[model samples]
Target: MNELRFRDVSVRFGGRRRGVTAVDRVDLTVPAGAVVGLVGESGSGKSTLARAAVGLAPLAGGAVLLDGRPLPRTPGRHGVQMVFQDPYSSLDPRMTVGASIAEAAPRGGNTTAEVARLLDLVELAPERAAQYPAQLSGGQRQRVALARALAARPDVIIADEITSALDVSIQGTVLNLVRDLQRRLSLSMLFISHNLAVVRYVSDLLAVMYLGRIVECGPVDDVLGDPQHPYTRQLLASAPRPGGIPTALTGAEATLDSAEPGDPHHPPPGCRFHPRCPVGPLVLPGRDDCRDTEPDGAQRRHQAACHYAAHASEQHNTRSTP
Candidate 1:
């Protein structure tokens, strides 16, 4: 039972900047009771995809279905909730923390009981219920925000870099809280972040995005442990490895820990990584057919638009880990 699914989704702003398509033809699925990690760099449309899932961004094109239902015309406040990156600002500076959670209660729902219930669910003491946003620490503030989103008991939760600014220890604490909450409530979550380490730690599946489209995606362990996509491998390798030599390796030649960015607007004709690709004839021999044109963002579920997926897959099957 998939809780939320995005099919050929695209979100574009009509303002200046030539109306960039923020979430481009992203096809994704949040299986029931799973924490799917939408991992990528900032502005990779992770947040936009989250917003579209919860109805904050318009569905410029494609479908965002909740529980197999196409997004409703009016996505109610309690339908899908968002936990912003900055907890301090995300909470109402003027309102008490308890009040913020109270605001999320459905009109007919047991407002007081639900608010208190969520607060407890997030591991907050009953006494802290009266505290204001200014009275809490960063972690505490985030807990309150999580409580607020859960107050509505939303079916889907879109957490965009929610723990990014917190101390590392605090991040672990908060991540544990989310993990606990997900299990306890059997919730479906879309955890958006640029932190691959964290994603590797928490998510069941991962989606790697660049420019706007998702370049690669699959089971987290498989994708992170043995990435088939060059971009995915580069991203995994980018993190500073302890006691390891820091050297630059371009494209396919690079290890997963040394990820890199590529041209956005005008990606390579066959594959976006062709210019920086360590592999020869990026589209490769058998994949020469894919060189005719790059696939649009529309096909997202388990495919990379790259012309070299087959070759890449074959390489993955034959080569040693980088």
Candidate 2:
């Protein structure tokens, strides 16, 4: 069985002293035939992690393992593929969709037959293969990207916000296609997005990133229904609902400033999230522990990096006991 494991992986850009740490000691696994959703804010390093999996980003510390073996920095070292957010930009406007897809197939393979099959797999007409990217809709172009990724026959698929550029209705179609393909092919996938609802829809396991660190991770329902991290809870609360009424997890209105404040280049001391965690100071008041010590990180299947994970639940329970 194929599995992609990121063991204590960390990614930093620029010099050690001045560089920004884009992905902090994050450990994640996308087991064979499972779809893992990674959700977080725009700068949470979700894309950076995905890029690392595909050899785009270099690891500063730790390793990215494929089937328990560390992946080499060279391209195609592991059978991992990626689909980007902008399908239009991902494909070459100069080449026909068929040519683009065929380029990814193994050398000496029947490019024509394979292209047809790939197009069909992505729910596109075979004739559409002859069309240029400029001739396709946003949704169709995205499908072409999926077809190209499929042509590689990779063991793991890293989809980086693939549906973020499409309309809502089109987004659903693309997501459904991904879900169907993942199940049918028994493919391991890392679906990255900032939208909670979208992630919740298609993931078996959910891992939440915050400021380059994985703040929470577990089974999809467990993390979504009972998010252990305050950041996770805040994201859930701020997501807009179908009825136009936004739910508040802590009665605080959603705003641009809801995210924890800290510099990516120079993170805060102790808990990177303590500066903004609403309950950390209250739970561990005047102790300096919350501000001085980072939690022991992930434990077991469900992990949360919070000093208040134990007491926060009790406090929430008490508040809702009425």
Candidate 3:
């Protein structure tokens, strides 16, 4: 069973004139005890989406359901918990680490000893529970936050860049701990990160987002290994590879099959990827609309909003324009 689900959720800030639509129509389902990854760049809406999952961010539009129930407009028992990027910001500076964990003890951790036990689960000595957030390193502080969330025994955990702030060595430890914790506790996780490597390490299913919408999504292996979406391909090409040759993604050429937005409510006419696409120079470089409008980053099974993707396999194989 899926523990958490987002149905065409949309969140926008400010007005049409100035505000940015942070999260566009997004639909995601996270299986109970499954580790799903939500990966994207800084402005790609990963954090906003994660915040929505945890009930910390208001939904400008659409529905968010937890275990088949509508989530309350406010944060409450949907058994959802979040581990933020900066452990220090999430943890209190004034309270002892133990005290902080005890306060949010998810399962009603009633005793100090139980709190210590939570620390043990996260691989902490439980003695460190006596220290404050300032006393612990970034990784250690995150463990404390994890322990606190574990105290609740949450059914769903939204880990938002919890390891991004840590050193590489510490990050590996924390990542392993998260994997171990999920296996032992059967906790469902929506792991959010911009790092493709990290996402690959943690997620079973992967979602690639651009702007505020999901551009492509599929099983981790399929999306990373044989990405069908042009954007996905671009990302893979840009990331480090075995030979370390950076396969550059030039703009994409526009094809006729692309979505055409008749009204502004619709995204825009032709392929959403026509702009900033590498091959656009050859296909429809003369067409200027691709430069004027915003593409709705919507998806249906590794969906590529590029019309050229209609011919991506044939066209992309060529790499450069003829």
- The 0-to-1 C-alpha lDDT of every candidate, in the order given, reads 0.75, 0.86, 0.75
**In candidate 3, how many Å is residue 189 off?**
1.0
The local lDDT score (0 to 100) that residue 189 gets in candidate 2 is 95
lDDT of 2 by residue, 150-176 (tens): 888999999999999998888999999
- Expressed as tens digits, the lDDT of each residue in 74-190 for candidate 1 is 555465788999999888888987778888776776766777788888888877878888889999999999988887768888889998989888899999888888888888888
Residue 317 in model 1: lDDT: 54
Give per-residue lDDT, candidate 3, residue 152: 71
The better-scoring model by TM-score among 1 and 3 is: 1
Itemize residue pairs with steric clashes in candidate 2. Answer: none
- The global Cα lDDT (0 to 1) of model 1 is 0.75
Residue-level lDDT tens digits of model 3 in 227-278: 6666676666667766766654333323322323222233433444444455
Q: What TM-score does each of the candidates earn?
A: 0.85, 0.94, 0.84
* lDDT score for candidate 3 against the true structure: 0.75
